[model samples]
Target chain A: MVTEKIIKVHAPATVANMVCGFDILGFAVKEPYDEMWIRLTEQPGITIINKDDYQLPAEPEKNVAGAALLAMLEELTQPVGFELTIRKHIKPGSGVGSSAASSAGAVVAANTLLNGVFSKEDLVRFAMNGEKLASGVKHADNIAPCIYGGVTLIRSIHPLDIVALTAPPLFVTIVHPQIEVRTADARSILKKQVYLKDAIKQWGNIAGLVSGLLQSDYALIGRSLEDVLIEPVRSILIPGFNTVKQKSREAGALGGGISGSGPSIFMLSKDEATAIAVEKVMQDEYQQLGLDHHTYVTTIHSSGVEIIKA
Target chain B: MVTEKIIKVHAPATVANMVCGFDILGFAVKEPYDEMWIRLTEQPGITIINKDDYQLPAEPEKNVAGAALLAMLEELTQPVGFELTIRKHIKPGSGVGSSAASSAGAVVAANTLLNGVFSKEDLVRFAMNGEKLASGVKHADNIAPCIYGGVTLIRSIHPLDIVALTAPPLFVTIVHPQIEVRTADARSILKKQVYLKDAIKQWGNIAGLVSGLLQSDYALIGRSLEDVLIEPVRSILIPGFNTVKQKSREAGALGGGISGSGPSIFMLSKDEATAIAVEKVMQDEYQQLGLDHHTYVTTIHSSGVEIIKA
Candidate 1:
């Protein structure tokens, strides 16, 4: 079953907590991704190399990538040792699914080295183990999109029901400010209990967003891209968030909000030109705040994880 | 603006609190509507005639139908008197939008006699005044669908934004048990606070249902019709509710739950034959409980409020 001597895979950065669908929806972006190179070894466990500038642990069990590979290997009948080389393009704590990209990339690379032993859904499960190690919550919001690509809905976590929604061809603009907002800090800011009235509005907007995506109604998507609950709390942690969102909409973004937790924001547009224009707005808003930020204008990643070289 | 001499309008019954969309979504049914006949009068207020078995108030300010007409009249620059005759077909407290039908029907009849003076949105606002009198809550769940037809979403109440969703051609089977479950009782039974986890699952299902309706995916509709919150509490009040739902699913219903509050349960099927099959299941379960129930096999009323004769 081990057909490949060496395998390299790429997993794209994902956007989680999508507007009205907090903790239940996500989608992949094309520009920023984490690349992993893996090769079989006689050693019993995973070994990491070329983790430049990153302070990730070299020990297999302690590393985010190693935890995912270990989880995947534990399920295999014919297990093999792997030596991984990670080239991290997505920065950690950027709120752009940096951890998910690494976790998903590692499992995908290991699965490829084993000649694709695991299904996409199984890979998502295994990748969630890495998420648990990284963020202490085994959430699939980022992992599902990183594994399946496109917009994905986590219908129920108890049964692990996930549906990959049909999305129109659209461009994405992301701006990651050079600041750290821990996932735990962002989550702790949220109210433990929400009003039933606000929850009803949230679900309605979620329904509208799903319809807009499937129907390719840009205006509907724009109108539906509103969050009444989570954003009001978590957005306060991100500096210039209000200005960035307003300016992006003013510059003709379909709509957008805080990407995942905070420190980064994303906007969706119908065309590349609008996406670029929206990126400028994001950049200018952050610049006015005297913050260093990185902007990426790209389309949605439809092809999730893929073997780049084997 | 008072151009017409007489007008007769029909407002169809509606299903509210649609599964995961509690208090925010509803759809109109074709059969079992309330008809209103209205004519301009020299008197400055609404007057009622032809009272049947129903004990509805005759006073324009206190009556559900009259309250809606009064609200509409308050917005008019040149208010006119109207004499209304309501032919009630939808029984009160049936959980099939009886009050909404009366309220929406009255405003529609009055608007027709005035040569279509108010928009549908304005009519919904006027009709909500009637809802406040009927259920002590100005909810649009039932009223929106009765006014707009098809599946409708109440996005936000503060701004009064409602979206009319596209739905597939499907048959509905409604069985109203001859027992009343007051709307106040239904509201009191629900927990003021729900787990954040369950709320996330609910919103996900709502999104899935909207996608299913718009895409005409029957299986998706069935899969998404589940409720993890409200039905658990309200279904306890309805006799043989569990058996009816299980048997209907066995009989090939797309899926279903309580129609609005309780006593009336509705099932949706992709075909008329399946709808008829599902209805028998409902009848058998209710018969076993020794309860008299009324069943209606109908389709979604696409054209909401229609002027029968003008």
Candidate 2:
């Protein structure tokens, strides 16, 4: 019998810039995950394989998974190579951290093959390369939660400080309206400057949100889940966004908003029933708009890239 | 002995905007309290007595405490009159919540006499009137902490939401440089608009600060005690502000910034020894600059207005 060095992992999906915590807060979800397998290769270079219909690049540099692996391999003192296979269940451009799952998945699998030598922060650092490849910038909002699991706060990026925050149990309902919102367009549309008053309100909301999560105050959480800056503008890009969100809250969601750059909307509820009910609200709203959409009812993922077969 | 029908309360000083949380976060301190006595009277109007040489106005409309009392009085269905005596230990224009102590003291005292008829939120609403009288704008950063005690986040003003936050054991050191930076001048110097990037950073810090305080993570709190918006502009108004803050950090204080608008600065330390050490640094820095200053070493006051003598 041959002793084969292979690692298979499940990397969860994530929601970034959660409501008032734009560019800072994010959390991993239980469903809509990506599966990846890594094998130690005698071939001194990386090999990429795509099993999904996304028809993603097999070239190491162009691929999200490949790009993330390349960054981690560079940090190793001893040379190592990996053969990567990706099966992405999370649809690309779904506004639910599709790129992050691919990026975080590859690095997490490669790290296991390397005997878990890299820290979660190191893995996040390598994974951000994939985000850069996907979005033309290195952002950890999605990558951090996808790698660290649970709810994560990207306190600072310059030195890379990640604060893993504990939140009360929550059910997440997501609806993707099947609209293409280029990340660049979302970035460009935001005003270069905002009123100081608005900024203060935004931070005040951020503070309240953090406090609510820490204290497990659901009402406070609902009150703080407001975005005065990005949501007002980017929400215009997603049809039925306001209706979906308002109706979801009416259906019993604590509160939620656009996931990442969006076209997808997410709502948080205290129970699975409410989450499912919120999901129905999303499905109905987009259905009435005659827009193609997808919805998921899930919970906050506890662990980031779960190891399957090692 | 006949009942005196008098209420004497001690209102502690507070530090508003506690670094990156401008217009949102604040905390009460134990020392530098204002002693006030509110007497039930049948005069059917308000009477003001000043025990200090600050020469504050005797007119109810012109006084901070009086203004706050007047606001609360309007809400009462039946007519109520009071004779208010104020002996303020917190200096006016020192930026250490001097006006807040007066306002909160009067309101808390009034509420106790009313048998706690109003909630903390109601008292905050009334106290904001004092803030308006003092600074021409109703702000609760100071009033919230001065009334609720410990740390408070004024989540919103229009709707009036106050979230009392629990913080880890900590010491507060304050320095008043005896120079006056008018509230109007301090506020007018701030930019009406801030860069979106900077605003993101500010909110990120606020999130981290709130998380740190709730989680009892001192290092996170220290890291988050940074203000890129208000501090840069307001610190210029306080002589030796930079040196006092920098030297205090070097002496092992966690981190801190301008207490409120300016002139008075506050530092947080893990213990009393460090707080006193930070105080000495404050004193030395101001002394070297040949500026007379006052310093206090205190802790967070868990109860807002302590009834010294009922």
Candidate 3:
């Protein structure tokens, strides 16, 4: 009955905690994705192969993709097995959702192998297991967008209420310097309490940002992309963040902030030209410091995981 | 050159702070508006008269409407004068934007007399003077919606950025329990700092609410009307608040909270029948306490200020 069993998927990179929308908003980008292949087997366990230079764990139990697939398999009524081959272009700890790309892609492919047995929400829940293993916490900001595509808002995590938000055409520019800012350290550095006055301003900016995105008001979007609470604290961890942000704005980006914690920064632009121009600004900053970095100029990826070969 | 020398305007009441969107969001309701008649005076001074039982100040500086008009006149390139006659239906200290009605109503009528010179945002700025006179701060949560005629988000007050958001059809049920909760007291009772975890939840709810309204997702809206920050402390100020909210939801209301500071509560419903049912639920709770209350079941007022007689 199994005519063809191998499935390959392209899971795009996502930028989580978009500026003012910390721990809630994210969107997928077209490039810098992971290439994942899943083979449905008669055996009832997960196997992972790392085809990239990052040298991720090949052991199924320790791997991000393996853990996520195992979680999905645990919920299935039918016994199924998956062998994942992940070719990751996104480097782990680069803060561009490298683990998310692999985990979300693995689940999407395995779900296809099972004839789409799970809802997208369920996939997100499964993927959180992978995220927890990677970051020591269960957060869906990156997973939701990587699974559902485009922009996503994780309203509540307890009941898992996620909303796919509409957005205008936007180009994303990413600059990931060769550095590591652990998610735990970044989170620990944040104050447990925030001033109520500052919180009000943050909510105002976030509400305005959401309104601007839904209405396609570009100027308003640009104006509302400011982050008062997280940026002030997290910017310290990322080297040359202030200068890069200032120079990028001078290069015509709408606005952006630390992508998923730190070390990697994302900027939103209106056009490909501006995106590329901002990319140049990002590259030059690290180049002057003699630090190696990678940059990508891409647009919003509407379809989340693409079925490359089925 | 102005043809319409005299104008009789109706300014609707607004529900501010809209649950989680403290100091940011609000919406205008259809009924319980104030009636004001403004005439272009030959003399360069503002005048006022009260035709209601609530004996508010009448002097230009002391009056809410007069202070708002005075603020507008100071910014005018040309000297203008206005004479006003007031008939207020919304009672002061009822927490439903009584001062905002008078302030926005006066400026709107005067703008007509001066051939519509001030922009809507400027009108909000001027009307904020009245709010400052009433409450100890210049907040636009009520003024923006009362002038812009829908759900309005005050993005920033420094430069006066306000956004008018689109929402689906919703019926508003208001029950004004005859008690005064001074805006200062309600604000002062709140902690100057909030837990980052609670703030995140509040922002998530507010972001969800905005997305829900934009997408017309009624279920999401209902689920997101929760306020973890302001409501917990302020709900105590309103008698029978917990029972009324609990019973209204049971009676098919979506959800809602304190109108502005409290003492008056508002609930949103899907249809007129549900709205009326929620209204009865609201009335019964206050009546059981032997508290005199006024209730109104009305839809969203699309146009904030209406010229009843021109």
Candidate 4:
């Protein structure tokens, strides 16, 4: 039932809520993504081929990719058939938006195979449904930047106002240690209420980040990227977050903090050399703990989802 | 006591927070300021000439303009004599940073007469001291705009991160009702702790406001300009705040909100005519209440503090 068309899809890894931009901003990584081969078939039912070692849900409706596709197809009455094979690169729940990448990637590939019936915005909306089923909250910070390249600012959740920012060239380094930290646990540890003083500082930092991104002022961006609200609560989950950040700063990174609900930490630098340096420091720390990990030195990626072998 | 040299100073009115931006952002008003005339004299001490009808403190440390001058003089060792005259324009406590204007204007004018020793940044730092004395808390959202024109993002209070933003061409309307709301009372009424859900929404709106200003998308700017954290708590002090906002939206305003600590409401529009229309509607509401008021229809001001006659 396989057709003559075989398409390779690349969905870039993304760091959600970059530092002070918790739940409101995100940007795409330039390298190391979960690759998938998607092909249309003459048969009526959707199929999933096993590729990665990680266990996936057998039911298509429960799988992130499958759930997203099902949601997209629900809008269309015509029976659509396709087989998807996913190669997981970024580990799930590493605070690097692994599920969002899969869900967003599948929808992008499926939409392209369907001749682009739904818009990119619609794709993001559909992907959020997948996230909702996964995490129980339809937060757009992770899904938006993965879908639309560069830095994305999610201004509102009710009507979902998301603006794609033209990012300056930033060296992004993400360190994912071989550890487990559930997002639900991270969310639970946060205090039910925060001081207004801290809230003001956070908003100020948000304004600074937005202005910094727009003007392409790297130093300003670095200075504005401090988190007084979320990072204080979340960093406790990561053993050496403060030490990693300090080392990264000493190694010429502008600044960095916990990536998403993290077991991963990310840093921003002015150049690739500095980014690599930060990565080395992270690796050194992980090695001290005698743990395996992965590090990526990437830039502000302007390209997002791509249709390969069309 | 008046000497030969006459120094004329102008301080632009500022809109603090610009809708969704609360306590962490502000921008300058182009025209109309509290102008002051200062003259070096042979007289041994600082003296205040006839100015506004109100009996402003003649003691340099007790008065806003006098405090600014004293702060400026602290840097200069040589004892100086001066006569200061004020032409008050910006109404105090209207939330358009009226005190900030007077303080910034005084320092700028004094610096002009003193051969320009203090830099703009230094002036802002000194003015923050003056603001601390005035409000019992040191914050730069108001003073930064008055000292450095255009939109200013105060990212932190400890290290004092401030970046001035060059705003796009947009019409502005500000209405100040002849009612006083003390900053201390406004500060005291708010609860110390806020719900996490509200904080999330506030941060989201702030991120939206920042992104909106950078992109220069008017509708996006309007949509993102929502303040859930501070506005709700603060608006209770101002009468007819909700109605004015509703009417302005009906009159085709992009958006509007409380200027700063309250009693003044500011709105932004795409054109001058609409700006005028919005102001008229706000004024009509004030008129209906049989209350005295003042309004300004202006644009984004690029000029900060300047000496007209040096």
lDDT per residue for candidate 2 within A168-270, as digits (tens), equals 9999999988889987788889999999999988988898898999999989999999999999999999999889888999999999999999978999999
Better of 2 and 4 by TM-score: 2
Best by DockQ: 3
lDDT digits (tens) for residues B43-77 of candidate 1:
78889874568877788888888999999989889
Docking class of 1: medium
For all candidates, the clash counts are 0, 0, 0, 0
How does model 3 fare in lDDT? 0.91
Ranking by TM-score: 2, 3, 4, 1
Provide the DockQ value for model 3. Answer: 0.91
User: How well is each residue in A1-310 modelled by candidate 1, as lDDT tens digits?
Assistant: 8664788888899999788899989999887988888898996778888566877778878888888888988887775788999888888899989889888988888887777768888888988988899888999999999989999988766677778888999899999999889998888778878877678778878987887888788888898899999999888888998988898888899899999897889999999999999988888888888999999999888878778998
- Model 2 Cα lDDT, one tens digit per residue, B211-267: 999999999999999999999999999989888889999999999999989789999
Lowest summed lDDT over 10 consecutive residues: which window, candidate 2 chain A?
Answer: A72-81
Q: In model 1, what is the error at residue B5, expressed in angstroms?
A: 4.8
DockQ of each: 0.62, 0.91, 0.91, 0.78
Q: State the fraction of real interface contacts model 4 keeps.
A: 0.86
* Model 2: TM-score for chain B: 0.98
Q: What is the TM-score of chain A alone in each candidate?
A: 0.96, 0.98, 0.98, 0.96
Instruction: Report RMSD (Å) for each prediction in the order shown.
Output: 2.9, 1.0, 1.4, 2.0
B-chain TM-score, every candidate? 0.97, 0.98, 0.98, 0.93
iRMS of every model, one decimal?
1.5, 0.6, 0.5, 1.2
